[model samples]
Target: DPTQRGGVILLSVISPEKYYQTSPLTLEACRACLRGIAQLHAAAWENTDLLQKATQQLSKASFHLTVRNPKELATCVESWKGFLQAFEPHMKQAGLWDKPSIHAMGERIAKLAQYISDQMTPSLVEQNDTTTTPQFSPYATLIHGDFKAMNAFLPKKYESACSSSDDNQH
Candidate 1:
């Protein structure tokens, strides 16, 4: 199961308070999460080597998941369309469909794919045209692409436990 795609290894059990999507979260947890992600981003930000490795792993871990090629742009577009269709009901219920930004985005779903293709495609930029240079954004960081409320987790501060000998002495 560890070798499977989407599998995770949780090593820390000393921290009893684990926050998940359904769990009632404190503002501190959210702040801590932001702080942690900021650290993660700072550590890997604009590191092309690390980014490439992460991207390669992501592509290998999924079915038909090459995202760095301009050819993959169509796939991105179709996937977005599929996602929009699948989530339309929920969006409507949540009043997101009526939002101006969302409505405007509905009109230009292909632009997201175009932006990715232009900014992330490995082979070339400008829709694979040779005249354009790779538009690797300086803003690139270790982003969790699939980060969602369902799988979200927040760490809690834990106090170290005293040993049996120490407890006996106390």
Candidate 2:
């Protein structure tokens, strides 16, 4: 009865006081986050052999979600508002907000996001007939459904780099 089960030894839970120190999450740290998501999607897309699989769905969603221009979108408006609130002080401090380079970069990123959305359509078909199964193979991949701070463990490199304010380098 005292022997280990399945050759496994269970360890006692540690106290919360022994937890690691909390550090701030920054937008600069999210490049790898975005890349990881893209990699997962690419793997799934390749395995499923579906190209614009939900074309009808995307068309409908686009009808409601479409905007004449990227800057006029509600999300962009909210984003710009938050960006101004968050970075206006920093810009004023650095004297870089009024520069053309920053404005051009912002426009470029906005346009790129819009372009990607324009190219992507629905990848799944809604079922109308119970007798028929969708032709496409189901491709599923592991997803970190909740990738918030609680699920994250800092790597040594990230821990060291976090102290530096060179967000641009990330």
Candidate 3:
């Protein structure tokens, strides 16, 4: 409670084996990961106001971009161009662009640049072509920009089961 201070703390000690272990790269694990991501997305979407407030507070001391207007879209495209140009020399020096796979990816991305810019145009986003197209529009939402498996934890039940199995093996 907010009013309480120095309350008793309960901690569960995990075995070394369990503590060091991570969920295996398996189909079940993949499904669980996707479910967790969907839950996180839903929660963020539901709490958009709170997320926006937090983001605004953080952005005061840093840089933040929101592409809600044509000018912002143009700015984003220009920024991407600048980034690609700045990194191109380093990428080539690293022999990354020499790889067939990387070259193909780069070609695909180049093809999409114009398409992305066209879609981001304010006129396209504001269009109401309901006769031929479905009535759908996209909006920005908060996302976990640094999501990774290393940052996730297994459910408590799985942890306990793993711990029990480890205990039996010992």
Q: Which candidate number would show the highest TM-score if scored against the true structure?
A: 1
In candidate 1, what are the lDDT values of residues 77-126, reduced to their tens digit? 56656766877876776678777676555346556545543344322123
TM-scores, all candidates, are: 0.42, 0.38, 0.36
Over 4 Å off, model 1: 1-14, 18-39, 52-98, 117-139, 156-170
Clashing pairs for model 2 are 54-122, 54-123
- How many pairs of residues in model 3 come into backbone collision? 0
* TM-score-sorted candidate list, best first: 1, 2, 3
Clash count, candidate 2: 2
TM-score of 2: 0.38
Residue pairs that clash (backbone atoms under 3 angstroms), model 1: none
State which candidate, 1 or 3, has the greater TM-score: 1
User: Once model 3 is optimally superposed onto the true structure by TM-score, how far is the C-alpha of residue 16 displaced, in angstroms?
Assistant: 10
State model 1's lDDT. Answer: 0.48
Instruction: Write model 2 residue lDDT over 1-170, tens digit each, in one string.
Output: 21112122335654444432134544444454566566756754534343433332122322222423334553664566567667776676678778776645545556565444444432344567847744332443223323554344434444445566555332
